[model samples]
Target: MATPEKTGDVAVHDEIQPAPLTTTNTIPDEYRELDNGEITAEALGGMVDDLPKGYYRSMSFIGTMLALCLGQSSCYFGFVMPANVLTIINEDIGPNPNYVWIALIWNLTQAVAFVLVGRLSDLLGRRWFFVGGQSIGLLGSIIACTAHNVPVLIVGSAFIGIGAGVQLSFGMVVGELIPNKHRGFGISCIFVSALPLTVFGPVVIRSMILHMGAGWRWSYYFNVMLLTVVVALFYFCYHPPTYAMLHARRANHVSPWKMVDFVGVLLFTAGLLVLLLGISWGGSMYPWKSGMVIGFIVGGAAILILLVLWEIYGAGDYPLIPIHLFKNRQYMGTILTAAVGSMVYYSLLVLWPVQITMLYDTDSMAIGWKSCIVAGASLLGQGACGVLVRVLGKHKLQLMVSVSLLTAFTGAMAATTPETPGMAVAFIFLASTFLGYVENVALTIGPFCLDASDLGLALGLLGATRSTLATTAQAIFTTILSNKLVTNIPKYVVPAVLDAGLPQSSVTDLLTALAAGNMTGVPGITPGITAAATEGNKQAYSHSFQIVYLAAVAFGVCGVLAATNAPNSESKFTNVVQRKLHHTGFDNKTTKEAEA
Candidate 1:
């Protein structure tokens, strides 16, 4: 009654009238409906006030931001945890020649699963897949905690890898949902989470292994608890929009067959699997020149070629990666920067832990704490980069600077020797900070270069690139580390054993024993011989660090060059606008009219 009393001054005005005429030129019923479907002035005006503008207000906005943060942290944890536990596992299980396989399997499984599961997430609802992935990761930790042998541990690692692939899918989902203004900050948050986990994961695992009775198993169990808590939180709070819902609302169509790119998925999965298998077994399980290794490499190359062709030309309407995305120079440039950045970042991760343990002669716990410095610094660096992006309106320059810092850090680390002062640890920490800066910039810029419709597939390809680079880096760097160890250990340890007056048979056994880090075989040698061999082992490890550090510098230099070529801010903004217009079905005429 109160509202009815206020109904006044409401003018019902018909200012214009249209003359009615029947003609063949009249709009058809369907065309009239299509014209009506166009976004109206009222709709545009309404969105200006209601649409989310930044990270603080929207629930879905905040949920996605947190989801991406947690998701990235979980992925990095799985990737780096095994490397942290490598020495501890070797000590407990006795050094088997197959120890490298345990490390390789983690990277291999992630590379293989990323493409397959990412596409499935686009086909299914992202909310369930995201939650399910975390659940699967929890199961992996449970299996790892109960693993009794190397094979079981490898199986557990594969599950963790799959979970990582699923977690990565959230990058695409969140990128799709967040408003353009807040996206760079949200993506930077994800990378910020990664820096800590990368730097600290090893440190944490090492500390637990040294202190706890069953350190390695307990470390796995701890991850399970953490991931389980995150999963529960995600289930209760996160709600990603479904593909069906989005498509139905936006395109007014829902066809599963049209939505999926099944053949592309198969080819990509097969190609990645073959490539990873080749890298995993080429030198360790089978000779690099062996028929099995060569066959895998060749077959993987073939499938990759086929995949590119299908994505570019073979697929009529549905392609996993839209070929047109590559036409955008900014998009391709950002992706290139990301690929190189991932390679350097993960390679350093693979090498640094081994270097610390071998050089410092510390147990896992000490290494874990030492690693915290790098991870913590990286978080700070990422935060700084985000601030700079907002102030300067230039992200590519930050990427270039980060790459230069990483290169400098790597070169400084290469200069370290066994007799180097404790201050050298600062070099590693600084390198981690620069690496984090590079990561934040690349992650922020990559998705922004693409159209909204391409966000899911673009992120999937980004994950694929990161996984591929990580696997390649692990394979190449491990090969370098192993070769260096093999070459240096004999040169240093053998001469030291003979100089100490050990018998020929004893010297041979002692050298082999030292290479494996088992002092039991040195009992036959004199006490002088034992002391010499221990010093010799230290010298060999120092030499290996030099090799790893040099390789890191080279990788960093390449990353810098790639970053230098990255696209500028104006190009990225233009590309994003074009993509959004395309996805919203606003043709050039409509866009021009709206602006006018």
Candidate 2:
């Protein structure tokens, strides 16, 4: 009556016969009729020798580490390194309003790329996308390095985001290579691989920007070097089975174009873009109630609703995003976790650095060191999570523990007023450590919850969620911070400025400068007024960050709720491919121990 539990990851190496999709009645026919023969070991195209079922256990570690290191390094290169010198870029561009487009364009495009690339890779293969993303990223860095104007830099940022988006899907590729048991450790290693960059990227970039004649341009040049390294590693070290090798035997003669739900793609991408475009504009370029903002926001939401309808009914056989995926409770729950973690992660990525700069007497190097604490703690947390999952075999517990810490620490951050350097360092490290655990657990558990066929799409969906939510979070906090400053600066500094002997003629200009947060830098303010204005600005930032931290706390609480909704999972990894092989009688000798 008692069934044995699965003790270890499924080690199935031989490719299983394609199973019918569980939920859908129709399968897209594009690759279905293409290659009808089974993929023999010789189909490797001279890439490598035949790897056995569960072969990833032996050769998988080193191969996975290399791929992860290269891929994630390229991806985060867009996210992290930019924050190190955003202010410098803003200054160099003469504080142009359009400068925000650098990050805005990058995140928007990256969000689109994440979903589209993931969907395509599922149909085609991941190799060319991997190679292409890095190549394009490298090209972007080159352009950015030489950029003389803000528009040129914005173009370069677009390339960086687009490439990084595709590179991000490599997580699923890594997921495919490793079995479940050691997969968390392998994922941890990928996050850890960025330690060197996180530790040194800012310091080096800041020094280059501040002292080297190359200025902020050197930041992109360094990105180029990192991208070049990833591309090189990819060629020699990467070799995974293509979708064609695995499923082309089942291909129908349907045109690939017919299989592509272009309408869905358009609706999905346009809806998000318009929504984010509206969000980005609100409280920054335009008022929230402005016609342009309201129209785009309403229109984007309506279009997205249309997308849902089409995918569910109208798309017939070819929905852009497979509709059944949304029905998978595990996939849906964990993907929301990814989105919330991203929202928290990205908002802090910008806000924390600003908080540290304004609250403490620190230079960019000091801020860089502070950032290293986060990176180091994340690596530590991720590595430790792998161990905990191995010993305890409960990833949901890890998720719970992570969100608990995140919620508490974020609450603490919200409470601590006038944050000192010591407080900033300690809080950042602790919060980041917990945040890292949450992310690693979500990402690692994602593939395990779905059938192998859905890995790319699921991960793509997660990638899209992460980017979109992050952008949304950024908009939310940027509005909160800017709105607060606009409200509070007058209350705190105006009386002080008017109280000073400055002329009444200067009042309008003074309010304008204060609103711009140029309290000290505004040209005509005397030393006394400048210092008072500085204090007022600092108070405004401090209060604004407290609100953001509180929001982060709310985000963490939502992560816990989301994790609670996860479909019950067995503690360790299940090799779906191997399990399917066993079920189909292809591997009848499956040891009882394999099922534990």
Candidate 3:
């Protein structure tokens, strides 16, 4: 149900046709029967109650969902393209230290925006927010495309991040639109559609960088055009149900500025961003004991503590996150499971591709294919997860088993020797597949347990956890690996270079390059020296990955233990049994009693 995006959440509802669907605007007489149970109280309750005219059921629904899917994919695609060409971008923009902020700004801004907008979106409908965000994102693309300096590009990325924050809202929209029976399938489609771009984004970017004859700026330009059409299509294709339109007009006397948990948003976002910055800068750009890093860590901790206290004690009539959501055993359990899964998988994402390039010496395309296998398999795993949950009748155990196996499997990969063939890559694929399952377990079970009113908060929290936790995990492990590489490379490298008859002066230069992670550069060295340098660098990096994978195994085991806390309140994992009603009689005693 979750896909990565930089935007806010989608609105409450969506539309769809029934089984044995038809494409024609005119429904056949037989096809009309398919509509019998198409609309349900659970599906339509928090969304629109009255259908709009010309809101034809079948293909129209698909078009709306498709547009959403494409919009999200573009954000991801745009994000990935820059990452692939960071080196070129760095070269083009000069060696300004601030250029790093191009990506960092997007990440922090998006994280902050998601937390703020999601809660406000519950009070305010998403139509205008959605359009405004797209407009802002387009502006970001235009800025980046036209940028002549690093600072300008950083500003552009920040705007893109704000716009992308709403991407998680698609889950809320999807859950409201599709029936419980079809929710999983619909959710899978949205996530799966991103795979094509995830798999091919590197290749496309590489082509644009290497052979397309266009500058790196064209990548942003291309995304801008693509998103433009998608925004237009979404504007035309999506028609909020009458209830959603009505909901927009009703004041409910709730001014967003008054109702929003601004203090909580400020504290939580500031705390998390500062903490991540401390983690990222600690051991690389600055020493852990540096005053700046220490200040960030200490201040972030204090702010986070205050955030929790405020959420519990001071939030009256408008909690940032409903207290009951945290108290709910299932919801908390899913959060734990997802956070651990994200940490492990993102760690793998950071370490494995490096492992491939060092251990196998593969090119960017080979890495792309291998990366695709991992991501493509993950997409397949997510789609099949809905079916697996359907058959298993309970997702907790299935997730536990998956995480347990992943623990053993991750450790198994750690045991690999440098000479191991595709064995490491194969295990990476398997590990990624299970990681997808762990995420889908939360996705599948979440909508089942929470009421429609809570869907946006639940989904926003889940998406935020996956992203921020993974980022934190990456910073931690990358620090570990980098520190280890700095210490270990001298031991394994200097002696090898001296043995290969390279002069000490030459060896000194070589070590400096390797220490900076530039194994491909020679700086006017002999072929034999180059070969020795490459082999020595590979040996050093391989050892670092061993530590990373072993740590991942430990997290994987913790994931298993966390899954045990999840509720088995229902035997069935599919949507069939959990029919949450958010209808008009919500306060009625009879309705409450029957639900209980």
Candidate 4:
């Protein structure tokens, strides 16, 4: 086996280095565990990339890959399934204005957990974390499926969000296990696993809502089952190599927990929570000008500032966020692009369904299939980009072209009208396709630039930054869209309905029914008045949605600038495996036992 050189207590590699040549004659015995679960680094064997090309074709490796893919699919479910069925859920559970929490809390928990989870997984092994995360998601599914109120549902969403956060951290695990050159393909495999669901998940959810009484809850039941299988798969299939440094630290009586930056964790978690809370509350639960909103925003900003200062000066050797990563142009550019791109996508993900429900069709099935086009298009884009990157290997150009095209397409969406629904669909599909390309570059590029030891921290920071920024952007977009709808409805719909011979006394009821997409019992309502009111409602939603798309276009311009800062690191791709899976008897081991 090739021996790894060490620096102090940690094993550090600044760049990808080819493993030393070894022959079967020089190979060591199969890794045997000590009674305490620790195995020496020498016994752990050589890098998997150094093995023969077809060495990874074994069933064990395939099972491991399947588990990773399934883990990613569960995260996708947590994000996509809930948002699509939220309105139906609210209808069954009463018209609670706070129903937005079902989505917000999911995002908020992830934004708060990414940094801590990433660093901890780096210190601790990843297997249990992956399994435990899915288990939590299963528990969350149970809770959400059984919820009778919005608050209960929000609590369930929070658990699922936390689980998704850890599942996202598995990106680091995927990077470490795959050869560096094949990272794009490896990462994309997990993403592509969600493609089937992205394309058809909405159809299934809508069908359930329409056909079965309380069938929306059945979606959560399916989630529970999927997560159960994911947890078991990860537990049985993922058997990662035991690192020597962990054993070294254990022998010296060092504690992994001691290395944690508790203060930084507190500051970051609290700050993100407060900031997102303030943003979510603004113009929804409270006015933007409310003292409560301003106070929370300002306080969160202050705490975050303190976190930066602490991470730089106060946290000793092991800061929660590695300070040096900020200096790498490629890493920073990737993070910025990913965050901004997600913000742009959020404009479509959150608002497009609302646009469909208000203007195009209220039938659950139609709304489901129609609103899912962008997601399906994005999946195709992601798959195409994955293959293209593997073949072409020019990420900078891909990012540049994708962001440029995405900007043009997103800006065009502002021209959507009730008469031009086809135009909106076309532009959004084009925008989403390019957005997927941008996402592909952002998700895979960071590993190329950073060292192997910092993989967990880097991936974690990327996920957290993207989640926080996107959540904040969603709030801003919703506020702008809501404010515009409030203004435009009164200006356009009120006049059109009144002119159609609708009585002034019944105007409020008529407007409410139009917004709700049900005109069952509005006084003085006639077919002519309904026709005029429908047209006006469509016009109001079109105008409001246009403003939201215009706002996303502004962010797209920023994404273009961020993409420029990214380097073309085609040379960094190589057949270097940072950490190889041991594939031994890890299924029965506890974390402390494994490290001992």
Candidate 5:
């Protein structure tokens, strides 16, 4: 082999090349020089030479698959655990007060941490932060497991949120290692693994809570064990990709200080934390018009403005978020669609179980099992879409179909009434399935638009967007439900009580008693008041569901519009040649010159 020559910032090989054995074997002339002074044939061959002779025997491949599986399992476990037991916790701890703030705080904290940690990991490597986050989460789990009060549980949940933020860094790391041809398959596989977890996690948690006389604390303990194992495995077996290794190999520059974006991070965190806290507490703890709420909103808005100004003007070329990425029409569309989809999906997850318990008078275990039907359907939908993408090669079409189905289901759900048939349960399952398809499609599509180097940031942004939207959606939906329930309960129940021949003065007492889940407070009421109150409770729940479903329908329609504008599957770029040609002005002449 002849000596490699430097051209501009790239190296070029001057020796003859060998025949390509696989598509990935084709090294573009730009990277061909980085082959360490070897001919193209030698360099390209060496890149993939580490593969095992047989697929099953490849320990590295197996490890990678397990890592992906664990990642999805952790995400599914984290999300479904809270939804399964939220109603029970509220009933036990809330004492008739709305616990919507709990949901909002969990989501908001996760979003804030995800963006801050993601950018930090991008600058500082993923190892220590990831390990430290898992440790903190473990401590939180211990606190929650041992907690006797709601305040302690909320603190524990905050730890879980921080851990989730740290775990998101793995998405980018996995993307970097997987081959382009297998990238979609790898992602799909990870997502598919979540199916079992989502379907069964709630069921198992609820069962444990009921059968063992355990509280929600046991669920936290289970998660602690699982996460501890995961942390240990990651610490011992995995090595995070370094900034120097990623950029230096490609002849790109790395500036540690610029990459950190400390000011941008601080401002972003402060803004998001304040905004989420305000949203969580407003209408639940403090009235929306209260001074505390106003202060949080105003403070958060100010911090957000500072973040935007710093990123746009003061950061120069090293802004934490490369705002230019948002200019891509497909990127913008996908992100918007993801936000709306998350809002609808997560709100339903939080509210549906409560509705089931209130309407059917079911126990937590039954509600948990019923919830599994939706997640099971989602798993099926995701799997079916993944196969369709592989065969029909129409990712966007699948996404559109999924969004349309979700919109229809949500719209139908909005029309539900006290007399709505039990068969309406199928709609929840269908909606979940469609939403799952939307999520899978968006996850696959977002990364295709960016270079491999930016995959981590892309995944982080996706998580952040989803978390933020979900937090706001939970708050809005909960407020609507609480207000409507508070108002409509009297209207429907008062009439029913009067018709049942109960004393008129007892109406207010009956409602207050029902809201507290106690029936002993009303005086001069007949035995029929219990039946009338049950009917009243049903009506109140139906009304809340009606409003929730309407909001979900609106969100689904927005998601559909966003998905319709997203790029088609054919626009995906994978090969080094395609990426280089797209970035630099690579034409046939440049290719021929490089060959010469």
Candidate 6:
């Protein structure tokens, strides 16, 4: 037996070690009742009812929840809200060809920063990163609200994206502080707490755009106020066992900063940005065979290959991603599921509003209400999945079922027509519902399979990988929509207008006017011809959108297969809390605290 060295109030091993095993024995003692040999496993099966003192029912826990909810709201406002109102923003700022950059930049920056934020927070601490993220988010809101150009909005989005990475990485915080059996429910509660924003955010933004003089800029202003309060709340209320972990690392003579995989981080960030840039350009900014497009895509793929080699051989003990993570079947399956799920979820988030405006309704308020269907359905699905996971204890089964349902509904969306707005909305609602459930199962599957020390990094990898894949998928879908519209609009609209007795010379004028949403300037345009042109435009958009949904269906099928491979998590769920919340008065004073 060896003596553990003392550092401040914590204990440490003399040498750096691999991640700890995720077993009941590894959970902090205060979270587990004394082994009196009389407590039944049935007693341990309850969710929140079994949560230890410092977690669910305490005031400190309430504070923690409030902080998490506010931060979650900021992430939603910074990315999701802006994404919905991008068209409005473009109208106000005057459209830029690079307006797509506003959304792409956010996803790119978040994916790039996700790796470092997770690793550093694990080594240094979680509190300041959380607070700093909100502060950055506030700055981004300020930048966006004042911006008069697309470039400035893109800049603001980049800053906000980094802040979003912090929130995504730290999502594991809730799982760690609660009973293992309740991880799904616990995480769901945080999301459900932000239900107001998820459901009504789009509608509110749309109303502002239509009714207020400031238009879309008001969304950013609201975020400024929200994030300002969140920054202060997190700074004061969100304290974990970070100081103890830092002290122990210091005692072991391990430099947290030195241990960082800077080279690995840079390689990953650059590789993803280059890859995404290449994807964004193909069929839009540049031709597929053009030197800029091919060069970026191939060069980025090569950099990623180099990164894999560096992680395996070049980085001694401090690889950015633990090599073992790649070997863990459960971990690999979890992240894979996460990536595919995000692809489906964000596809709807980004494209559904466009679909509404193009095919169903052009009014701002109508578009806003239509968009709310997805969010409302998704929240219900999240709550259901969380409750079911707690009761059934079959994570793999839940994942398989959810992903399959999502696939079926998404594939159904490909059948949409200009005349079937009702059916299209139904398909979106069902797809979004299952998409939410799939996300919960994927996130819950992680903690049960990995070590506490690895959890933060693992979560980071999940967020980064999912963000990257989803962003790539989005770029592909956008390209498909753009290319299809180029062909389909003229294919459908030109014929109908010509057949309706419009002169040959007026054909071009009609198209340009229709594209600009104003038929006032077109020659030879009449009420009957205007109606014909409108129908043709809707048909073209419907067909183009159908292609996007089919692509989403392909991704969804892959997710279903991945879900089938997820590890059984029944045994992993228990009364044991992996990490206990400290600095909270509800913790048992008599028990010695556990060190990370």
Judged by whole-model lDDT over C-alpha atoms, candidate 5 comes out at 0.66
Residue-wise C-alpha lDDT for candidate 3, range 270-369, written one tens digit per residue: 8878876776667767787899988988887888888888988997666786667777777777777878877877677556667776778567777655
Candidate 1, residue 485: how far the Cα is off, in Å: 3.1
Q: What's the CA error at residue 433 for candidate 1, in Å?
A: 1.2
For model 3, give the RMSD to the true fold.
9.6
Please give, for residues 1-596, the per-residue lDDT of candidate 5 as tens digits: 77856644445444323233243255544333333422222112222322223322334335545654665576555545765667677776664354544445567667977766666665555556767876776776777677666777777777777876766555555554554444455566776776667678788777666676666666776777878877775665444444443334332433566567878888888888888788777777888899998899889989988888898888765578777777777776787787887787778777777777787646656777777766777777667655656455566676777788988986787676656646457788888788777776777677766654455677788888888778778778888898898878887788888898878777778877888888776886767878887888788779877887887777778888888778775434243321110111211122234335
Better of 5 and 6 by lDDT: 6
Model 4 poorest 10 in a row by lDDT: 28-37
Number of the top lDDT candidate:
6
Misplaced by over 4 Å in model 6 are 1-59, 243-252, 586-588, 591-596
Residue pairs in collision within model 1: 203-368, 206-364, 206-365, 207-364, 207-365
RMSD of 2: 8.4
lDDT of 6 by residue, 469-547 (tens): 8877877888889989999999999899888888889988888899888997788888888988998999999999888
Query: Model 6 clash pairs?
Result: none
Candidate 2: residue 280 lDDT (0-100)? 81
Report RMSD (Å) for each prediction in the order shown: 10.0, 8.4, 9.6, 6.3, 6.9, 5.6
Backbone clashes in model 4, listed as residue pairs: none
lDDT of 1 by residue, 465-544 (tens): 77787667667777777788888998888888788887777766787676576766565677788888887887898888
Q: What is the TM-score of each candidate against the true structure?
A: 0.80, 0.82, 0.82, 0.88, 0.84, 0.88
Which 10 consecutive residues of model 1 have the lowest summed lDDT? 574-583
- Assess each prediction's global lDDT (C-alpha) against the native: 0.64, 0.68, 0.65, 0.76, 0.66, 0.76
Ranking by lDDT: 6, 4, 2, 5, 3, 1
Q: Cα RMSD (Å) between model 5 and the true structure?
A: 6.9
lDDT of 6 at 583: 55
